[model samples]
Every structure is written in C-alpha cells, then in structure tokens.
Target: MSVLPLVFTSGWASGINAYAVVLLLGVFGATGLADEVPESLQRTDVLVVAGLLFLCEAVADKIPYVDSAWDTVHTVVRPVAGAVVAALLAGTSGSLPELAAGAVGGSTALMSHLVKAGTRMAVNTSPEPFSNVGVSVAEDLGVAGVITLAVFHPVAAAVVAGSLLLLGMVILVFLASRIRRFLRRRAQRREERSLAGAGRHRPHG
Candidate 1:
C-alpha cells in the first residue's frame, strides 16, 4: 500500500521515465541512448539512476569553487528534471494534477538549487580547504540519505524534503543579502582608507 503511493507520487511529480532518460543522458552523455533498453525495465533503471544522480549532485555541490560551477551547470538541468518528474507523476492522474505536480517539482528543484548555491558561495569565503571539503562531504551524505529514504518512502519524504528545500531557500536568500551588504561596506571602507592614505602622502603644496 505504502509503496504504491510512493511510487505513484514520485512518478507523477517527476515522470520517472523521463527522469530515467535524462539520468542516462547525464551519465552516458548523448550517445549512450542509441542502444535502448527494453521498455519494461526502463522505469526500474530510472529510479536507481535518479537516486544515484541526486546523490552525486549533492556531493558535488559541496566542493567549494567546484560546487559553484556545478550549480551553474545544474541551473538548466534541475528544472528539466523537475518537469520530467512532474509529467511522469501527472500521467498517472488527470490534467490538473499533472500541472500541479510539475509546479511543485520545479519549485522544489529551484529552491534546492538556490540554497545549495548560496551555501557554496559562503564556503568560498572561508580560507580553510579541509573544513570546506569536510562540510561538502557531510552535505552530500545527508542529501543522499534523505533521497534514499524518499525513494523508499516518497510521500512522507516528499513533504519533508519539499519543506526543507523551501526553508533552505529562505535562509539562503537572507544570508546572501547580508553577505552582499557586508562586502559592499567593506569595499567602501577600503576605498575611504586608500583615499585618506593618498591625501597624507601628497606634498603640502
């Protein structure tokens, strides 16, 4: 009973088939799909691949400057995945439900991306490479754990994951704004100091 809803919800939210196709594309690139798997086993493959991809992404996202680059790449990929998931899930239901699923999946993906990106930016500001790597690895593990659980128990996982993604976005936005303001202030102070130093150095003419 539980497994059916979980599968249905995940499928509806992201179009498990579509997600599988995209995941294969990501792993093998464009050429890999030339030799197709039989239709029957494709869904199972996709679920496995999607779980792995999400785990990989979560880990890659913690890699300091590398993570920033990863996020930039995913800016395109994440939304597409979300759309696919939604479409897949929607196929099980009616039109209205399909649209709703797409919206939820896309929004959740976007929120997750933004929060992860912001955290990477903050990590970049830190000087300790070891600390950054450690944090990144931990984050990847946490994401993988949750996603694995979601795969096994999607309904509860979906609600909890979606809520966390939303909360993360809010926090990231607030922190990013503060970081920007601090940088701006620091720049202004440095400029003022430089100007004052120049004045002192000028001859009394």
Candidate 2:
C-alpha cells in the first residue's frame, strides 16, 4: 500500500483532533485493523498517552471560550503531530518517501486546523451552549468515522475528507461578518456589565 491516502485522510482528522486520531490509529493498528501503522505508534505507552489526552480534549472541546483557548495553544501542535504520524506511516509503507509524506500530512493538517479554529471562533460568538456541544460532538464523530474508513477505504475517505474541508472553508467565509458582529456585541455587553458593577461599588457623595 502507498499510504498516501491514509496520510491525507489522517492529516485532515489530526487537525480537528490530533489526540483522537492518534488513539484511533494506535488501537486499530494494534488490533490488526490497519497494517500500515508503524510499530512506534502501536506501543502500549503511546496508546495510553493518546487515550488520556483524547479524554481531556473530548471534555474541553465542548466548552465555549475554553475551546478557543485550547485551539490557540494547539495551533502548532496539531500540524506537527500530523507530520510525525505521516512520516511514521510512510516508513512502514516503504514505497513512499518519508519527507514527502510528512509535507503532505503537515500541509493538510495546517489547512484543516485553520478551518477548525476559525469555525470554533465563530461558534464561540454565540451565547448558547448547545451549538458548541453539537459542533464538538460532530467533529469527534467525523474524526472517528474518517479514520475507520481510511483503514479500509483510504481513497474514498480522502475524497470525503477533502469535500468536508472545502465545505468548512466556504462556511467560514460566509459567516465571517456575522461572527464579527456577534463578538462585538458580546464585548460591549461585557464592558457594560463591568461598568455597572463598578458604579454599584462607588461611594455616594
């Protein structure tokens, strides 16, 4: 197997949820579901770490502002993880060059990461909690489904992943203005609240 399709698909998944991708790939590879996964990724230590991180991410991802902060911290982490995973898969495949695989994986991860971060920022502008939770759950499911399909049908999974990336980009572009307006209103409300609180504490002349 070339591992190219897997590289592309995993990269896309990694951007949205690197820890989940790691956990899924490690579990699948360990259980004989994916043969192209490298031995390094299948180690017990790696799986344990990935599992814990994924658990933490799954919870934090549903929170409103917290998720945006988390995304800021992981702007670099996701793409690097994607490149490393791609390089490892390339090593196992033997047919693909490791550097080339890493580049493809890293670039795809970067693009998807941007999309995820942008969407989350837009979503955070909303005061309701349900939308954030809904989006987070959908991302988790999408990552899991894509990874599972990549193991058996890499090409098809890659196509699906690509389509999703395009759709996300379009949505982000269309909603940019609304996101900005929502954020401004939220900030103004917060400032007013702070001013009101200060006024209440002032001494009467």
lDDT of 1 by residue, 88-149 (tens): 54454343465665666665556565666676666666666675677666554444444445
**Regions of candidate 2 where Cα sits further than 4 Å from its true position:** 182-205
Instruction: Evaluate all candidate structures by whole-model CA lDDT and list the values in order.
Output: 0.53, 0.91
Query: Which candidate wins on TM-score?
Result: 2
Judged by whole-model lDDT over C-alpha atoms, candidate 2 comes out at 0.91
| lDDT measured at residue 111 in model 1 versus the true structure, 0 to 100 | 56
- Per-residue lDDT tens digits of candidate 2, residues 1-205? 6789999999999999999998999999999988888888889999999999999998899998788779889999999999999999999999889999999998899999999988988888787988999999999999999999999999999999999999999998988986687568668978999999999999999
Clashing pairs in 1: 11-89, 12-89, 12-90, 13-85, 13-86, 14-84, 14-85, 14-86, 15-85, 15-88
Which candidate's lDDT is highest?
2
| Alpha-carbon shift of residue 134 in model 1 (angstroms) | 3.1
